[model samples]
Target: MDADFLLIRKMKQGEDKAFDLFVHKYYKEILTYCNYHCPNKEYAEDLTQETFVRFFAKLSDFHYRGKTKNYLYTISGNLCRDFYKKVKEIPVEAMELTEKTEPMEHQMTDVVNKLTLEWALKQLPDEFHEVLILYYFQELKLKEIADALKISLPLVKYRLKQARKQLERLLGEEEIYESGSKTCEL
Candidate 1:
């Protein structure tokens, strides 16, 4: 039995608390995605609100066809696009993206490495950046990414492949592949 199916059944049965549970589960992830896309924390909060509002409004159409996370992200991604279109006049590229200050415990090398990586990601086109962030940072499955992007599975694979190649080029070196482990480490 799929736990997501059970949750959807409970939600369909008019369990008002189910929506709250769902929000609590996905709120942070949705917000993080919004912040990354919009690069403004307060506006991202509003986008997150729009995401949940749309989800609840469309609740009657909900089904267990895919993981709820996939559904939520699809909604969030669409909202992000809509928000951008609405605010198309504003040049978000000119607005500086403020990085939340992290604790100074890390060594200088680690900080530089992180900064370099962020720079590299920013240098990529939006499509490459989106695929890399969804696959690596958010830890979403390729299928989930396909569903969220509303793209075919094979296209998702191709995008991921292209993103990896671009990242290697941007990083100036390729990570050493660990055979059988499915991971590449520097």
Candidate 2:
């Protein structure tokens, strides 16, 4: 059996240390996922902690539907959605952003691009944004993303394609063909 199953088994047998290890392994990842939504480190940390709490509470009900990492992401996503609903965050625009230091040409361009990209990502529908974050930013495989999102493989593929197209449109890509060909590999 794989290590996932082994870890689950240990946790099921009431091994506190195993669960602690599991939490330790995924803590940083879950926090990072939350940060993609909230941007504030403290808020993301709270969301991450809540994700772990919810996951641990529902551990027995987890019937090996997918990997634990994906499950945690799903929980994190849901919590973030809830949080955003209440606060209705407005992302900062690229032009409105100030430089942190004297930036070289490449670094300035990179920062502006990243900020624009983040804003563009927010412009996308929540589902599309989630898929893009999972596939591109988090570097999850299509299949893994599918499993994590609890959707079919084809739907995941379709959403990813649509997200890329939407991003290119939002960013005003000159070469549609070249942008479409990007598979978002890490």
Candidate 3:
């Protein structure tokens, strides 16, 4: 197991390898999460870099009271929040459609619906978005997500329910059509 505790210990002792290991483990996830939340790739990339920089600067102060991933994610989330505050004057509507769409398994008609769900996720309140992403994409259990987001399990369930309802409202019949139909293996 990649013990984040060990990594943090090495990091606190100023080991370069530990820092490299941390980046290797988290860079993709951090970038993906930030990109999903931010308006543009440039902003996402900047936030990702800033998150790591802040993480490194604060490594010595880390108390290891929780999973390193959760702690790191909390830091990343805070950086994203700060960025959002700075860019608050920019219209949210203007931020939409900045991401380029590529060919998906579903056609354009369905792509809009899929993107609608994703965009709605991005638009969700941070707590709901964090819980949903941690639970679904990260595949963490409710308890794990609650620990990660520092919320209670009941609150995690409630947020997940709200997120699902919102997503269903955005996806609607498209979800049924895609899921109810059988898939043929090539």
- Work out the TM-score per prediction: 0.69, 0.78, 0.75
In angstroms, give how far residue 166 of model 3 lies from its true place.
Answer: 2.6
> For model 3, what is the C-alpha lDDT against the true structure?
0.72
lDDT per residue (tens digit) for residues 77-124 in model 1:
788778867875444454444454755555445546655765676677
In order, candidate lDDTs are 0.73, 0.79, 0.72
Residue range 58-86, candidate 3, lDDT tens digits: 77777876487777677878888888788
lDDT of 1 at 136: 67
| C-alpha RMSD for every candidate | 5.1, 4.5, 5.4
Give the CA lDDT, 0 to 100, for residue 70 in model 3.
73
Error of 2 at 118 (Å): 1.8
**Model 1 TM:** 0.69
